[model samples]
Target: MADFDVKPSVIDRVRDRPRRLQRLAVLIVILGMGLALLYPLLRDRHGAPIEVRDVPRLPPENLAVIPLAASPTDDPRRVALGRRLFFDARLSPLGRSCGNCHVPASYGTLRAARSPGLGDQLDEFNVPTVLNAALSPYLGWKGKITSLADQLHRVINNPRHMGSNWAWVIETLSADSDYRSRFSALYADGITRSSITDAILAFERSLVTPGAPFDRYLRGEFGALTSEQIAGYELFKDYGCIACHQGRNLGGNLIIRFGILEDPFKDGFFDAATPKSKRFLKLRVPSLRNVAKTGPYLHDGSVETLEEVVRLMARYQLGREMPEEDVRRIVAFLHSLTAPLPENFR
Candidate 1:
């Protein structure tokens, strides 16, 4: 070996490297300990835990046992006025009424996925039935509006729905001698935007669906539902549909993002152009009381037939592909939920 190479062995250099690494390791451990000690202090400096579940469900007295609604207000005249306004096409500048989209015969959902608004584009979401709206803890798919009155105001202003400004709505209704007189009589403070909302809300509250076959079954009417319907009800509960869709209206107690079990929106079930938050992927659970009539099911109106809806829910909500026979039976059961329209609604 060369003399220079023999002067310092490779092992000597390796030993020096180990010492350097040990010093660096010690420094890193010290730094870690300091961060661990300061972590609690940093965490405590920020926000406290928030209590979120304080809001209560609508009181029992306010809801119908089957197709739930708020208990009728003491003012009958206001409700009567509301009913007239509900059917009046004059509420819109385009001569369209609420019934134009929310066909009472169709369980409140619009025939098309979206109804034409003021613009060329269709409305974003399906026109949910006005039936049982009062039973919901919050309004709209996102639960944005809290009260029926607030919802009415937003819809009137929404160009796609009512397409009228506050001033125009007030002026339009005020000009109607009949509407102005009605508003004056119902509201203590006289006609105003607030009074208009009150009248509309009063009518909405009156749109209740009662005496359905399902209601009869709940009331111990053994023959109200056929054997297939009974089987479907069993499947509805057994498959965990009752977990989210329960209570009087059969839904609307809580806001759950859609596609909890599977991503239904991924397969083009909803409009991709809409914001992610506003898509059919997120929604409040809808009432299934009149599910049969509410055709073109789902928020995007992707599934038209009740059988398809049942299968989709089974696959998406339950995470299991349901058999066709099972789906058909469930559809039969859903049909029982369709109560004869209230005489007043007719």
Candidate 2:
């Protein structure tokens, strides 16, 4: 070897240039494919295309909840597959399905105040309904997540929710020929973490229950709501309840601090064992849709009856304890928010 002759000749450098470029190109392709595969697992963090408040001035309240929307792309085949995935128990490590807490019979949420999770632990926050959840600005009781796509990861991994992560979820789902076939039909990647979550999102977005009497009333069918219910609607706006709770899904679009004037959590509503810091504030105002059926109410499932829920809202959100009669009127109005599932969904 020449001691001072280590440098390659210009010809040698030129000859190696294409090899270097080829390796770089291969690396780029590998990385791109890896990202395409990984996109679903990380997609939840992308937030929403439009912020909750930025959603185009929603159609008239009645027109907001249209018949179950034909998925985002209006693909019936994809949405149909998603429906099966939505109810499949194999999605979880413990075999408890998403339907375990959000039963369709009870309007996408269970009757339990705080939904039961794997083992004996009850979820810390209430299980909000999947109905119209896509319209929500944020998901979770605290409104931490922004879009339905993002929340799927949280739900799948949260110990109190699906109680499983991609490791087991992917292997389990990938092993099923039927599930694999469904995923393949809908997604080129097939049975991936992202595809699985996306399918569920499609199904959930289709879960909207339109044609409720209240929706009809909003559509100019003046007689859809009763005299009492109409009066209750008046009271709802008069009391400023509409401020936080008025949107396509009523309350899901806004985040209202749970206790503006006073802390409902400070009262006996939450168990003393629960942390005091988590008690109240910045909570996603839940949708009033089908609220009558989705009880016990609140993030903790503390209140048992809708009547009491009205009274508590008056005391906490409004800072004035409402009279039984006024609460009665408001409860009647809230009932108008309930809508039945479209026939196909039912």
Candidate 3:
């Protein structure tokens, strides 16, 4: 072979191979770490990092809130006291707190279709979310309860529900030093039946979820929702869902018969063992605000998913079966109604 002198530049490049490799490794590691850090955010329910800067500056016209139930006493002291009492599981006969059935992360409703209470007795009806409770006139499926206090009182007294009575709940709270202090700050008379229930009611009234994509859309930020979601909204209005599910809280303001077309009680919505009555009896239409999270839909919570809920609603309420595509679009629209509760709630 002929003798050849390799260029100094080529020799230096060959010698620096390790340094280049190190730099390449460092770049790869940095990218991997960045992906690892971003993975959790990728799992966010919104599917994207919230862009607060891109939010609309002006509220949409024709957007109005329909107050269904009156807000609990706005006294900061009272509201604060109520907030504590709400999560106090000690008041229940069992260890389960108010947050048990109505979970804050689940938009104030538990994941279960029917909540098990006190031990053997399960809540026969699906537990409704306490969120936006203030926007409804009546509480419960029958729509008989008039106020939050009344709702609290009913829950506490129901052996199958709270599984605790007024006397036990009051005495239990009174014995707790923390509760005693909280009650004292809010009530002059201490933790009585009225005070205990009042505190819980006040806290529940504040469980409202706001800032949903639909709310933003209604507020003139038309960009808040995806085209699929907006299509669902149109189907919602066109299909007459807006008749009962209109207003800010959407459906919380009205009481409507479940089976306007066919009696769902035939499916045993209310204990099939019981003799069927007129299926036209009204139920307090639940708020759709958090329906996406507050699943196992309807009063009985028989339907497990929102799509099934939509199917049932169409067949039973509208007397027609919706197209699968329509169901999907409407379900997407319903998801737009889901908003996070303000901070310090959960």
lDDT of model number 1: 0.75
Better TM-score candidate (2, 3): 2
Task: Please tell me which model should have the higher TM-score, number 1 or number 2.
Answer: 2
TM-score of 1: 0.76
Please provide, for model 1 over 20-136, each residue's C-alpha lDDT reduced to its tens digit, 9 standing for 90 to 100. 788998999999999999989877664233222222444653233344333566378887877777777877787777777777777666788766766688765777888878767
- Please list the residue runs of candidate 3 whose C-alpha ends up more than 4 Å from where it truly belongs after superposition: 1-73, 265-274, 278-281
Clashes within 3 Å, all models in order: 1, 1, 1
What are the per-residue Cα lDDT tens digits for candidate 2 across 277-333? 776668888878788888888888888999988888888888887888888888887
Pairs that collide, model 3? 60-219
* Model 2 pairs in collision: 44-150
- Give the C-alpha miss distance for residue 116 in model 2, angstroms: 1.7
How many clashes show up in model 1?
A: 1
What TM-score would every model get versus the actual structure?
0.76, 0.77, 0.74
**Model 1 pairs in collision:** 108-129
